[model samples]
Target: MSIEEDRAVQAAQDTVVRETDNGYRVLGSPEESVTHQHDIDRIPQFDVTQEMVSGSGENQEAWLTYGGNYEMHRYTTADVIGPDNVNDLEVEYDISVGSGSSMEGSPVIVPGDPTVMYQSNGPNHIKAIDARNGDVLWSYTYAVPSDVVLCCDDNNRGPAVWQDKVYMTTLDSGVVALNRYTGEEEWYTSTADHERGYSATWAPIVHDGTIYTGSAGGEYGVRGFHTAIDAETGEQKWFTRTCPEEEFVGDSINQAAGTNWMTATYDEERDVLYMPVGNPGPDFDGSVRPGPNRNTCGTLCIDAETGERLWFHQESPHDVWDYDSASPRMLIRDLEFDHRDEVRDTVVNAGKTGWAYSMDAETGQLITRSDPGVQQLNMFSMIPHIDDGRRGTFMPGGMGGCDWHPATYNHETGLVYYKMHNNAQEAWWRFEEFEEGRKYWGGILEDETEAMPDEYNGHISSISAFDPTTGKLVWRDWIDSDTYLWGGTMSTTTGLMFAGTQNGQFIAYDAETGERLWEFDTGDAPLSSSPISWYDPDEGKQYIAIQVGGSGWLRRGKRDDRVVVFSLAE
Candidate 1:
């Protein structure tokens, strides 16, 4: 069969077997991915070198890492699939991610003799499949202990590849490495004890033979940390506590619960890492955790190799609203602002506070803060106790004006594309003493989705663009839906942005104007994961893929954990 024809043909879903009951409960054997007529050697072997990862922008054939490139720009340069022919894109194949998984991540594509991609499901389950025809190659899993304590819902945000191994962080706090081609376990390193409510939900980024990862469980009042592990030996190279006493504003102990819970952005040129830490413990009852909570609800810039602190900026000082700052920022060089006359290197933070912050990358100083991306209300007022019966209803109820969803940046246009949330919640708090594995939340929230006022009622989210330099809103595409948009946007050089909706719509929008171009309904499941585009040189075809994982809070359709791929119809 012609390479193009083979790629356009939908791969059989049964090409790989999956358990329909519990996600990753029953593991596939080491050689389960090799089909009856499949030859494992058909796929080429190529090293995902450090240089390729750093220069991922130049290599559009694959998505090297989580942020696409170290700069954290999710944009691609693929030109084959674009605005004009996007309408012709059709389903190539759809496969199951097993029964009990919630895929909240994006796939890492590796183009080769037979291009293949690696995907991660909830609680640390991974699978490798042929990118061309969606033939399953291998599967691996690390079942999290039942006694493991969890702060957030169980969700794995995909995996990272370096040299010949694939890396995944587990809900049980294990960072396991697998053979990139064979899916066999090479080594396993536990980052934290799961018995103490510590877990690893964030996908780690591997750089220069070192894998960088951080812990979860800020809600459990655990002291947070980020560690660097040797990719080959699984030895911890460096360890840095996120909230040190000296970094705290008043040397208060309340600053102890900050965790670097999201994937970090790296500046390879300077050998520095930019990471966002989560909110402090007893989230709503801030009276106990006094003084700005220094490193919590903020972004930190540190040395990549040694894990030394460079500079830090606290976004929500004394944050009492559960405003855990987990949004990742882009490290843009030569950024311009309307108020400033000269251009400077800057990091544009799309924070949970619903505002975009442009900061000086060199010093971590605020350059400018743009208008609220969503409705930012009740600015950090003291939370009333639940007994008060005077619950405060506010916009961005813990879910954020921006959540963990990623925003893509277009350096050429200087406009960042983001999926903004317009959510509200009724909240109140109460204090609780620390206990080893128990939650430390000093408050609780009630969803007011039905009582939302007239103005913010129509849509749960909006796809918008902002000029990071001047803190301006260029355009916004409102998505009218009862459910929120869990998916993020990915753009290409062809002047188009692709995004998935919780309602199962895979849409194409004009990058310049936020105009809806084309859309496809991928069954009933929510497309909770982000979409990525890649061009395979041999087949000379560009394709798009996303995971319909549904939300942990609510799901729209029946096909919950499915991988759907699309390409131009033959």
Candidate 2:
């Protein structure tokens, strides 16, 4: 179907469903009208080059990389608004970006031009807005298949900008580039076929002249891969499969699922790109897929120029649990550890197994593994007996120890901050044959009530700070929610930690002491994405921004889809 026809169908479907006060509503169509464009002369356009993005760690004007920098630290040096005056922070501007199923994208401000920011919503809708005021400049929508099978919600992480163009992946497994000034499409290319259960949900990263991205369909038994494309022409430069072909285990190519569903980090000096691979196919039942899955459930480092696999360190080998190492890998350089004599460069990642791992970036060797961040009862236990209708309880259920939320690293204190939840689930299985384009899992995960009492129903969620060098916990604070804390965390140079909760509170904590500093209620909606901060030169103020909307686990009532920016009240 053409793009226009698909949009018309979506609009027609939206008319039949209405949002109620209690939160239940069908998916709505994209906004037809665009926000009136502001005077272009007032906004300055800055050249966003590869060098600028590489050195984005010190960036105070704009957030270029997905994790706020190339190292994926999610830390900012801007300290104009610190803990001293954070209580005075108030909403500066809040603009609705249309009502959608989910809003997971992180807003990226134009380089040197903090007045302009770019964002994307669920269903692949892109928009450019005046950062100072909440006025949309231009918007673009991509056609989506009506019957796409997604294990999660229809979501897009965000976009990558280089030079004068913005690049993003479509819900139907296609990549497109757009003019940053005007939302006109420059080029588009199909990354994979949607019918085969291949999709792209995470943000793509652009370095030099190449754009890098990965596929997302491990739940559908899709053979995952990483692709590099020419940023200028949208031409395929190289493609490397996450699952190695030499190791023929379990249904071979068809059942080997090592999808990359999270944003990757790039090492400019080493010319290596680190990609996080998801779980193998048939998450609960891995009997058919035998042998230690080669590259799945691990971090794969590859040569950026040639797409060659440099090395891989598997976090979970021959896994029975759905412990995907899909979190963003934070690269820390010149790390001195108490255990080791030599200073080594390390990459740290949090896995669903409720453990944090730090590995040598160059050789993929295990540097250290921290104590369990969450409950680990029945962890690594054998798959439950499925001959009868009995169910078994498993800790750190499919939702994850640390899902796709990007963890943050604070350079000032040499500490890593991440959110984790302890939600044990009951599982039982029924063998089934694999079918094309269908959920190919060999069994089902059923709830086991007899295993635990009703009072123990709610999950425990907490935010933890740890030292990766010694695998020691620095501080831990439990949240007041039974639901998982799915949002990302951000640390600032002024010793402040920020994170949004599933219950709609955007919170700030004292980084050193884990004390609650300040919080703002975001309409009681889930802030599933990360929080970002940038300094606005024109106003001499530092603004913190985050996307607030409904997410997969917390979507029940009327939802609000908008980006909220906060700054100290004048």
**TM-scores, one per candidate:** 0.90, 0.91
For residues 486-549, what per-residue lDDT tens digits would candidate 1 score against the true structure? 7567888888888887777888988888888998888667777888878888877888888886
In order, candidate lDDTs are 0.75, 0.77
Q: lDDT of model 2 at residue 472?
A: 84
Which segments of candidate 1 are over 4 A away from where they belong?
Answer: 1-39, 247-255, 449-457, 554-559
Q: Write model 2 residue lDDT over 1-570, tens digit each, in one string.
A: 122233322442352222232112223444441222334344456668877887777978778878888889999988887779889888999877754556778878775454778888666777777787767666666655554556666678889888888888876677889878777688888888877777787889989989999988776778989989999999999998888877646455676888989989998879898989888877767667768878988899999999899999998887667778888999999999867787988999998887889999899999899987877776676667588755667777765688787999987889899998667766655565766666765555543335653434355677888889988878887766545577689999988999988788888988888888998898777778888888888788888889988655332223457899987533
Query: Worst 10-residue stretch by lDDT in candidate 1?
Result: 3-12
* Clashing residue pairs, backbone N/CA/C < 3 A, model 1: 22-100, 23-100, 292-318
Colliding residue pairs in candidate 2:
23-557, 23-558
Q: Would you give me the overall lDDT of model 2? A: 0.77
Best by the TM-score measure: 2
